[model samples]
Target: MIDMIQQFASCCRAAGLRISTSEILDCFRHLQLIDISDEMQFKTTLRTNFIKNYREQGKFDQLYHLFFHELRTDIEIARSTPLGSLVKDVLENLNQNPTDNPSKSILDFLSGDPIGFLEEIRSIQSEGNEPMQGPIKGPRSNLGSLARRLKIMLQIYAVQESIMNFLAENKSKVSWETNKNLKTYFSQRLDRARRYLHEDPPAYPDNSSHVTSYEKYLTQLGERNFASLTPKEVDEMRIVIAHWVRKLKDTIGLRYSRNNRGIIDVKQTLRDTMKYYGVPLKISYRKRPKRKGKIVTLCDVSGSVWSAARFMLNMLYSLQECFAKVRSFVFVAEMDEVTRIFENNDINEAIDKALKEANISYNADTDYGSAFRNFKRSYMDALNKKTTLIIIGDGRSNYTNPEEDIFDEMREKCRRVVWLNPEPKVFWYTGDSEMRTYEVYCHQIRVCGNLNQLMDFINDLVL
Candidate 1:
């Protein structure tokens, strides 16, 4: 039990949680006072000792779940039994000639220890890209980390196939029940590994404490990251957002109406004074421009970013009258204009349809450069000096060309380029992210990881 706890602590540390030696010792000391078999008490004790702040809670929870539940290799079969021997034999055969660290680590994980596999994943997640040099003019991406991950995934697939083949060959030797258990065991392990590899790390809370009075109602769910929201939370979010949109529309309408008189025109006022025998009988106010603001948004709908983007689009369309026009495009690897979808259908229905029926491939690798290039080619005419180009994405281009040149051109063509990144500031420049490269061209860049931040951006846009 102590060994398992210690190993779990090590895994937590590897996953970027600050688990100190003193804390581990304190956790052990406290564990002696409680019944360790009580899972709730056990988890609470560990979390209380290890988690330093609210920001670390999400990461700590993920690590704890992974180590305790996902990585447990608890097969009911006894080692003396034929099923156990077959399991051991299969692992031994796969491990006889280990090809690489990742494969070896995977096999070790299946064999009941996941410390090495966890470390491998940590290394990949934390790998930094090399600095850009003279000619490229952008960050030089290193696909070495991505390649390593792909290799690990392929190794998992190979292991799964090998396990199935071994079971097929030995089906007659073992009972049907034993074969079924063995297959289920290995399948679960491999699938967990695959899921852990594919999933993005939980977003750390934003460190900046820019509190606003508007976020008073948004006590809990408003601060929660969009990607971390459950289905119920999402439904709650939609309700809150609908109320917010209505409030904003009323507020903007009143504000615009209050300012209908526009600014005083000094020359016009003086000219009218001359007509009144040099005594100002009346003052003249310049007419406010009748043209409304126009917005063009390029939203990245690839997995994680999509969670935030949909809400942003919903708000933009719900308050569509605030702008003369709101043209939206969704993209994964390629751009697809979904402006018509929103125009024809109800806001929520449009958002759902856009997600499902957009002409881009969601499964394709995220290539921001490709998407930007496609947009420039097909929709360059959509932008004018009156248009504000808002881009909602994490800026992860997957080591592809960022095509900053085209972005620069788009900047010149539009009134302003505002980027709303769902990722925290700390992760902006890491891995395959091209945020640093594209940052120069943006007129404004905000971390819109939660409802408050998104609401703040929309408020600024409308008012």
Candidate 2:
């Protein structure tokens, strides 16, 4: 029982749940007080000792269900039953054929130990999105995992077929009941394996604040989530954003003018006094060097993230004169600079062209780590002390490595890094999101799920 608990804990850890050795000991201690035969009591005791946070309960429940219910068997039929020898014989025969050879993990699963197979699944699910490092580059996506899964599925099918063929050939040697039981047991185990491959783990519920107080404008659409917008609402939203852009431009100009007066430049004044023969006959007023704000925006154009990013990009370019230079980038698993798209075309036209023409793979999964690495490799020079780097995305890297070090480097190079997450604030740290990992490096993180939130951020940014 202790070994089983430890193994289950290992599985949970592999699936990205945080489990400690002390927790395992505590679980063992707790189990002694509960009736082990009572499934509910046993599960509750284990859950209490193992799970630390309410947010992690969903993952705990999934692993628990998978380990105790789906993977458990009533008896050790593979070793103790009379059919054990028959199963071994069949496996030996299957192994003899090189072309139909299954992966060692699959074979281990068939032989009754599923740990190897579970590890394979975990690895596949958590595979990194780092691109191939060579002269020749190719797009990266989830397809590699899918292909591996397909191969496993096919192998399972082959194993089932081989077992059926073996049973048919040796039917006379075993009783009818024995054959039926053998088929049913292997069938169930194989089916369980297939189901596990498809079962995506649930993400923790996001507990972030829904909305912040802002002056309400177009109350209905302004407050509505960007992901929930309809076609008509999106069109209406463009008009509203254009109006805001104009207002923001005027506001930026006014703010700049209000703060434009220079402080007394003592050195320049002293030099000018020398020209006046060291007398206070002529007074010289020093002129202020205009501060130019440069902005570099990296926007994730994947799925619903694009909904919020498009509007942000639109407003940024529409008020481009407010900034000395505005560079735009869009990314899915890879990033491409779209600054030129905006420069040569109208703001709306540029946005449309960026979506269609940017050298990015739209079908690939979101990989912020890869995008950051790519940016560092190609556009590291674009960042400077005067550049405000705004990253717009949901921060979901699909269980890939987040490469927070790269993000931290980015923060160092830029004036300030602001993350605008389109996902609800509650969902920022959930599932495959790398928000928490990258959050520490960001100057600010705002939940830009709606127009109001977006406006609030832009307002603060320019004014």
Candidate 3:
């Protein structure tokens, strides 16, 4: 029973739940006090020992369902006449073909050890998006994980077909009552596997609050995803953004004021003391410490997450004084410096010009792999230990190579990496999103689609 509990903890950890050794030990000690045959008490004991908070409970419950119910041993199915031998024969036939991951995982699911199937499901849910090989064709989708699930679903159907065919050929081998119960039990198990393919673990808040503490009036447009806003709403957003820029500036100024003052200048203090006949008079501090850190921004204006880039650019340039130098790059398939655009134009015009004439192929598919490669090849020198690299995107690389090595290299070259994903947290690992891939190297990941998220991020940065 303790071994079984430990195995369950292992499954939970594989599913991205943070189960610790101490928690498992606690679970072990607690289970000894409970009636193991009572399923509710058993589940409650495990849940109480492992799950720490409400947000994590959704994932915890899913893991529990997959572990206990879907993966339960089929002792009932095995006991009925020749059915056990029949199931073994069918599974042997299915395994005759060279098995891929989909086949292997489903086969594991049927044998009452759902660990392999659970692990595969976890991978699909957390799978990072990368480009699939082909032309820049029509409407593209990141269907790699989805496609794999469909294949497994077909395999499950095929197994049922094989079972039906076997029963027709050997009806005399098993009695009617045994056959009926056996088929029903296996059918229920297969249905459980089908449900696993469609199960959604949990989703974080999508369109949450628009009201920031600083905003006096409730902002209607602030809540909208930037890329989806209309022209009129865009104008309103600019007004709201101006206020944010000013507030960020004030906040930054306050930080510099409080933190950057240097050591006392003894020479200047003594010079002033002469006016008071050698008595200490006015004391003077040395100049403020140099704000020499660099901030490098890689904005994905891939049209999918367009609004985020415009406002993010507006914010970065407005608070340009916060850093010694600010470098901005925009990319879809390629990246190019757009600091000159902002340098020459007003904030609004610069943003418009960046979208229109930054020399990026706006029509091209987003290839984060290629973008990261280009950044490493061309602009790696711009990064230093004093640099903070901020990436703004949906992290959807259009099913292309993720090039996570380049990303990690850049991470090592900088003080920190911040990924501001405009996509809702729910959609992050879905489709072509490389959010999960890049998240490993990021110091922070924030949902930045709405103005509230943007405001919150800036508040963290400056306040």
Candidate 4:
């Protein structure tokens, strides 16, 4: 029971609840006040003691069902019936086995009959006799032991079938129902599975520690090394990543400067104008119009860089509020402006459309030269001395023509050109990556991989 409590607490943590050993102890103390024999009383006591929020309550309910739900004895018996006999008989004759077999077997054993099948098997084993091969194990073993093992196997199969059915039925709603941590875990697992099936074989992690929470065990089904991570640890990672994403975008532009000589004080201007309004021939200085800032985002939505593209899109969407003008473009084979998508506040829809319109073949090929040339021709009028051209890509053009001249032309038009590459600087010149070719033309180039790197890059951009 103590182990069960601890397991429940761990599940709560995975569901984004913060639980400690002390809390589990407190729950035990509360359980003492309830009737131990009453299932409902025990459940009520735990819920009242442990769950404090709606989210925790939902998690508690799921854990409770998984732990307490038991299959009926009849169902267990039916499932444990020899698989070979069941399948052959049912498929060939389309007939059900006589239900009296189990009852008669139980009655014969209970009647103290010396002719019982189990007794006969034990007699043979006791005489060092080897039983013939069969689907069901020899009856020399205790029926109770066999039943327990068979029940566990059947339960596992049932749970797996349930999971598949749930996933198939709730494909769209799964995203909404599952928390971010679980989603990340599942997505990573699916990716690993695909990679294992199609690419290089994945190394399995050692499963030495048998004692782990259910969530951790589930994660291990996807990744062996991932078995040690608790739900709390996964949630912590999600929270940390979310914080970094917000911080990175916040730092990605020029800080508002109070000391800009170009910005006129309206109150001071009005005061100066009032002094000259009342009399003789006096001239008043005209107020200067604020200088509008220009922002040009060139993001790579190519197959190889989709993850980075998503993160960059999120950053740019946030930046739309701070900038005067944001011209967003996605590139693969060519560049297409997607500023309107951001304008409408439909980021997911916009990304879907952008991916379709860009027609960038995933992992196929990248033509930076063609993308830049197309951008220059289409949006040349929008480029000016005030414009900041921000390019986000891995810089892997598949050894295609980089067209450094287009970048030079872009540098001539924009105030500053900043290249944000997701790949590490070490890989900049490796393989077919063309980052080195275009790096020379950009005014600023930074490696923006994880959120920490991105935040540092953004801080530099703004400063």
The prediction achieving the highest lDDT against the true structure is: 1
- lDDT per residue as tens, model 1, 197-245: 8786677765545445334545678999999999988888889889999
The models' CA-based lDDT, in order, is 0.86, 0.82, 0.79, 0.57
TM per candidate comes to 0.49, 0.49, 0.52, 0.42
Candidate 2 local distance difference test against the native: 0.82
In the predicted model 3, the residue pairs found to clash are 130-399, 130-400, 131-399, 131-400, 132-399
Off by over 4 Å in 2: 1-217, 263-287
- N/CA/C clash count, model 3: 5
Between prediction 3 and prediction 4, the one with superior lDDT is 3
Candidate 3: misplaced stretches above 4 Å?
A: 1-217, 258-261, 290-292
lDDT of 4 at 208: 36
Poorest 10 consecutive residues of model 3 by lDDT? Answer: 205-214
Model 4 residue pairs with clashes: 14-231, 253-462, 254-462
Better of 1 and 4 by TM-score: 1
Q: Give the distance in Å from residue 222's predicted Cα in candidate 2 to where it truly belongs.
A: 0.7
- Give me the candidate number with maximum TM-score: 3
Candidate 3, residue 28: the lDDT equals 85
Superposition TM-score, candidate 4 onto the true structure: 0.42
lDDT winner between candidates 1 and 2: 1
RMSD (Cα, Å) for all candidates, in order, is 25.6, 25.2, 23.3, 25.0
**Model 2 pairs in collision:** 206-426, 208-426
Two-way TM-score contest, 1 vs 2, winner: 1
